[model samples]
Target: MLELIAIFAAAASGDVDQVKSVQQRDEDIVVTGQRTEGSDDYGVSEQRTATRLPLSQKETPQSVSVVTRAQIQDFQLNSVNEVLATVPGVSVLAAETDRFYYSARGFEITTFQIDGIGQPFAFGIQTGSLDTSFFDRIEVVRGAPGLLSFTGNPSAVVNYVRKRPYREFHTTASAQYGSFNNLRLDSDVSVPLTADGSVRARAVGSVLDTDSHLDRYHLTRWTGYGIVEADLGPNTIVSAGYGHQDHDTDNAQWGAVPLLYGDGTRFDFARNSNTGQPWSGWGVIDRQIFGDLTHQFGNGWSAKVSVLRRAIDEDNELFYVYGNPSRTAPEGINAATGEGVFSYPGKFVGPTRNLTIDAYVNGKVSLGGRSHDVMFGIQRGAERYRQDAAYDFGQIGVAIPLSQLFAGTFPRPPFRRSTACTSSTAPRGGCPCTV
Candidate 1:
């Protein structure tokens, strides 16, 4: 477990209703404006992911949990999976070094959204790899949200609310250094870019380099993001942003070692006893460009249009060992017993591109002296996947003997260049962790 503590300072400000409340008497000016909601409460939140309506925690009719920006800073949660694990009734299954599956309500969750808009895109365990620095809050709604997300499954939905540009100028930076050659830095700055302060811009960056306790396990990662906003008029707002993240790992394990021998004799191995080939690892590079437009109508209704284009490029390789020992050869695995299997090398080199568009509107109507908020929207998403290599089944990789399992002295398998990984086959049990 990695433990870290940080000290941070924040400035708080609130925007009141547009109605000007001012009084001048005896050469003295007095102004009064009510705060947006109630007093500051960490336990309460104005959630929109549940119904696309601005409803307080007490008003929403669903089981929801909100991880606020303050909580993220206090707990030092930097990734999507770390934040989700802290939520109520959420569980994660880590099948591989890079694969993580989320489950809620006894079913694997496949529905997720950004700013309350969701697409038909199937989420992979790699969703955990997303950076959280660009978001203001994370909202999780338990149970099926077919009405809002249009997913008929009983799994839950997670929404990431992006941070908007601020007119005021503020900047914060933090750095940390720890064991195993670990070094990290995070910084963000928000500033006004116009004379009238109608346009704003914000930028955030992070860098990390760390070595794990496990032998030969090390990682290096970096992320950069920036956003700009313009207030075209009193009721129209537009914004654009770009985000990119890159990471690489060393000595990544394809699969765990065998637990017991073919004769039911268990093997006592050290924690770092890995079957990972020297050339096996994950090198991920992903980037996105997104923009959104919002217009507030004169009739108290609002509409929004959002578009995002994302691309994922990964080069990963793996080595797995598990099968029965061959009767004649001490190092060979028998096809029938399936115990002392030889090491096999495989690679995945598929890159995927995704374009998603979502639009929606929110308004209120009165009936029978009761007020109700209504919302409607449409979404379209397209994904393209390309493969550059292929895996051949008949040709097996290099094999090691069962006696050399713990000493790490066995001949490692040759690294196979990646072809098409989970990127394209994810729809067909390739990313079984996805669902």
Candidate 2:
């Protein structure tokens, strides 16, 4: 009888221990339902990319597509190109190994935003592969978004929402490897700096090195981003951040390979073959600094001001080869001797800088038992860039055998550029009020 009583007592103690563990687990989880950075959920409960006002997917009038952090991780969309390819009605164009462009609804996308502030692009092309490590989510607003965005492009507006520093400490790391010798590593860390969790900082970095299926093509890129947020009062907050990225590509083709030989007959080439010299390459460097200030009033009203400055530098060394190839002599190439020639080697450098500032206030008002939302916003931007100077490389390159070209055995001579250079500056500003 005494032994049976002892067993019951022990069972009661075990139940108490389990209950304590559950309580501790619940306390450790921080769920505010306001932020989606670390949610690991495929869809967001609220979105504000279309308009500064908070609204759900169903409430927003425009067609919106949100690519959350969970989707980015699950689908391995490490670069901006890969992420956009998954969005509906969007098309990605690879102009070359380093340059890319995107289009939606049969029109080129010219407006891109970061945290609901942006500048219109004069040329609708993106240089280098933009890493996706720093973004919490990407929002695509199809059709015209001129209600908020300054530019009235009929295509689409892409907004990249940055990940904010969490109130609690958290860290995550991941690595990926795939075909063609591709390897990627990503790391994100968030830390609270104040005892009351009023100050926080976050850092994100990524590195990627890979070789393409195309012959002699290779790419290496790395990115680093850091941000800090501090709460000044109960309803006010300020934040600042900086980011840097470097992308370098080697053996990038300037143009497509010859489709037909000099003869009328077809000249089929291997799928992996490319008409590029081994010495051709392009490199780009990007740096950005930004800050934000936000405040909330008691009457469901909020105001925010954001500013960003971005700079981009590019260096290009391109080799273009064009000619028809045929086994028969005189018509195209003589496979026996290996002799053909069509090559242009050139080098150029260009630099661009931009500064943008945006401020907005939005709130809700009730009248006659009905609530209405209104917003007023202003945006100012300036861009300065040097024009591309075409360098003079005397004479065409000497003829090299087709076999030698395919074997990566080609000579690269030095290029001389012009002494004169020109630059241009563009300024833009707008004020848009919506209700």
Which candidate leads in lDDT? 2
- Tens-digit lDDT string for candidate 2 (81-173): 999999999999977667678999999888899888886574457878989998988999898877777775888999988888988899999
lDDT, residue 393, model 1? 51
List model 1 lDDT by residue over 369-395, tens digit each: 998888888988777765454344544
Candidate 1 Cα outliers beyond 4 Å, as residue runs: 1-44, 119-123, 324-339, 388-397, 402-435
TM-score for each of the candidates: 0.82, 0.84
